[model samples]
Target: MSTVDLGDVDRFTVAALGPVGQRTFLLQCRSEQTVLTLKVEKQQVAVLAEYLGRLLRDLPRPGHLPEDLEVEEPVEPHWVVGTMGVSYDAELDRIVLIAEELVPEDEEGDAARFTVTREQAAAFAVRATRLVEAGRPPCPLCGGPIDPSGHACPRTNGHRPPTN
Candidate 1:
């Protein structure tokens, strides 16, 4: 088993590539010396963002906050995420993300454990919300996402229903 300890990470964020409904989501963590990108499910990203926001809101304020909130776009991912764990480190005064890599049987999987400041976590939540909301709008008839090419709304039964 391999482990990457991205101690006191400089930046962390979730991003999606390609068009909505056909997008590839990613979790990126960076330090001064290392940049790591991990492939993650879009749903996972959404859940994490919500959880992080709640966690930060509940915890007492940490004295120092990260000054900048910018996420960089990188070309490739180091690994695809299999499982994840999030917790607070009281001693370090940071939120920790433990991301395990997906690997084939007989191969040792890698795990990345990184810590981010409260401010960074909050910013990540905001960015993730925006990224998710920017996707395809919901269909009025069935409440499902409407693709650019239009959606076959179940409520309409493949017919052009009257639009209000």
Candidate 2:
């Protein structure tokens, strides 16, 4: 297996291309000289954002905080992520992302590991929260997403369709 270690990254963010309902989500990390993009599921992005927010909230403040954070879409993805792991690195004061690449049975898989600062983690969490909330509104009755066309609310028993 191969590994892409981007130690002390400059930027990291989750982004989606296209509309919320029909979007392709990505986890992107970059340094001054390198950029790495990985395909990820929307649900994974949402969960990571939520969990990262909670994690950062519980940790002590770092010595330095980023003034601003930016999210940029890469030209192409290096690999699609099959699984991912996130953790805090106290020694480096960074948030680590370990993304395992998806590969065929005969081929060896690669892992992309990167570290972003605490400030970047906070920014990522905020952006992720916004991205998740930007999706279609939830049905009041069934709690399912209310699509632009319509929604079949379980509570209605097929009698009436929920309005967008």
Candidate 3:
């Protein structure tokens, strides 16, 4: 399969566009003149943040987190991610993120890989966590999103819908 290797990124971030519960999540990386953007799911962003945070906990503390973690526009995505993998490169003290494009099982999918400094990774995790949390609040009973109108919580057994 083809691959886009962004050896080291000047900036890397996850961003959500549009309103909460109706947002489009994106993963972006920029290295010099090259910029790569891929579409990702909301759950993917949440899990990535959690995994990155866990990974960083075992490594040396970041000296300084990146100041800017915004996703650069035009916001076009190269492909939608079907699967992703992340790992820490201890020797280089950097984090590697690999995203594979969504494709049919019989087809070969493209891949993008990038490396980020510990500082960038830390900043990314923090920013991503905040972004994911900024969405609609979850129902205490059913663990599903409580809409602006109301939530038909499964635990309610259709007796009453909770209004947020």
lDDT of 2 by residue, 31-149 (tens): 78788888888778888898888888888764455545454656477888888899988777778889998888788898988888778888788787888888888898888888888
Global Cα lDDT for candidate 2: 0.81
Best by TM-score: 3
Model 3, span 60-146: residue lDDT tens: 899988888778876999899999999889898889999999999999999999999989888889999999999998888888998
Per-residue lDDT of 120 in model 3: 89
lDDT digits (tens) for residues 20-132 of candidate 1: 78888888889996889889987788889999988988988645555454547563998899889999988888898999888887788999999998888887888888887
Q: Candidate 1: where are CA atoms >4 Å away?
A: 61-73, 104-107, 138-144, 153-164
Alpha carbon lDDT of each predicted model: 0.83, 0.81, 0.90
Measured on C-alpha atoms, candidate 1 has an lDDT of 0.83
Backbone clash total for model 2 is 0
Better of 1 and 3 by TM-score: 3
Question: Could you tell me which 10 consecutive residues in candidate 2 have the lowest summed lDDT?
Answer: 62-71
Deviation (Å) of 110 in candidate 1: 1.4
List pairs with backbone clashes in candidate 1.
Answer: none
